[model samples]
Target: MAIHSPSLVELHAFLAVARVGSFRGAAEALHVTQAAVSRAVQRLEEQLGVDVFERSGAGVRLTPQGTALRRRTEKHVAALEAAALALRRPTERLRLRISVAPSFGTLWLLPRLPDFHAHHPEVALEFRQYHHEENFQREDVDLWIALKAQAHQRWPRQVAAEYLVGREIVAVCAPQRARGVASADQLLAQPLLYHSNYPDNWALWAEAAGSALPAQWRGTGFDLVLNLVEAARAGMGFAVVQRCMVEDDVAAGRLAMPVAACASTGRGYYLCRRRSLGAHPAVERFVDWLRLQCAGDRGA
Candidate 1:
């Protein structure tokens, strides 16, 4: 039968004494008194029913048993320290990680953040410009807001979701780019930026405008609406983008309608997350506020 089973605190004391080889030294290392160190070591030895150290001529040496015990105790001691270190951190914070389309982050969310922050100062909002259909689990995210269809397809069925906006998608460009956009063919003659995921956007808008786009309307590619909008704003090309997401920029006289017609893309933004994450007060509050904001919007 074993002499004793050691408790973690006793092992801590044992490891300290065995490492330093002196009660006083162990006491200093442990930030404890010499008497406490002696008691701890005495308890360890008594529990084990073996001499762990040899004392002679102003120094100490470890017994064979002590050496073996040291090995075992060291591993446990390191594990204990690591576990303590992990627990020492604050695991919870009033923060939200929201991944969104690049254009929406810049043209919409960026402008409205101050309003959210003003209401909930404790909540820190972190907005990331992930692609609309990009998976969010790769990053440490608490919540995500993306075009609704993409969110539904990527996340599990258990996430509680709500639509945030039904935006009007229309072709927009700089005034110079919009100048000769009379017929679909003329409009199509100009370079058109195509979103990789939505290849048919330009075609759909052209159909809405009652003309087939010129064969070369598909001139360049853009991954996100913001890049397309930036290109259009700079007069490089024209691309279709969501109106609500670009309203502020449109109002600022930076972009103009490249075509008179707008198409209902049957898409909207959705607030999404695992149902469990909804329990967090900050997340819940943000969702509620977001829903209220959406309800007040005329487009929704």
Candidate 2:
């Protein structure tokens, strides 16, 4: 008997269904109708002369033949993806796509990006603002910068990470709001502003400074640190913020620390990237620049 070869489309449909465990899910992933996905899978099964999936009340399950086929074809799919990526970047200039936490991107990186452009004239940089919980594997991002509890832990298997900088939580307010705050206890007496994600920042800072939060403390919470900084600068309330994030505001007299106390939660920003792209020239140059920036921040 002559062997039949399955087309890439058939293989893709089979893999999608196998991975997702549903024809409906595969259709959604492939951006086609469920009937189209069913037809593709049926054609592939006919060509192979074996049932690929066992249908049951729960959903589709891959048969032994399907599992074996998947193991053999997975690498070929990955290779095709790599080739497609290479073809998409036919330009001479190195292009880098980076996804950064929103606050860091707006408050920290945006201000220093011109320097990177100045230094790396041959590189084209694209930036995306992303939340910490987003999955980078599904995105086109080549690099990411975000806060993590520990620099070494909690990364996806496909990526690698390194410590970027430590965060020091400090109590800040407008200079006017700072006028009467002679001590940590006095600072806590004012209305408190909070970051929604790090609601305990003020509480932690209070503990570190050996001060108790006042029973009548009024508070407002914001989803992003950038908004918290703005609220602090407006003299709305005292905000416990990462010192590195509000350094410029503090320096420019937009915000002031009411108490000379800070707490390090052992959490810090980290630079991350797909392990495969770790050695790419563009990624290497960007990582080097990031380290230089951190060093400069420390020196300042």
Best by lDDT: 2
Candidate 2 displacement at residue 122 in angstroms: 1.7
Q: Write the per-residue lDDT of candidate 1 for residues 1-300, one digit (tens) a residue.
A: 855678776787778878888877776555456787778778888888998888888877789999999987798678877676445433354667777755666767778878888898877777665764555454477777767654235445445455677555777788777775776667677777777777777777888888776674446778877787788888887777776766666777788775567776767777766543423556766877777666765353
Q: Which residue ranges in model 1 land beyond 4 Å of their true spot?
A: 1-93, 127-139, 148-155, 180-185, 292-300
| Each prediction's whole-model lDDT (CA) | 0.71, 0.81
What is the C-alpha lDDT profile of model 2 across 137-231, one tens digit per residue?
74578888977844245777555667776567888999998896899878887889998777777778999999877656669999988899899
Local error of candidate 2 at 84, Å?
20
Cα displacement (angstroms), candidate 2, residue 281, comes to 1.7
lDDT of candidate model 1 versus the reference: 0.71
Lowest summed lDDT across 10 adjacent residues in model 2 is found at 84-93
Sequence-dependent TM-score of model 2: 0.66
Please report, as a residue range, the 10-residue window in candidate 1 with the lowest summed lDDT: 149-158
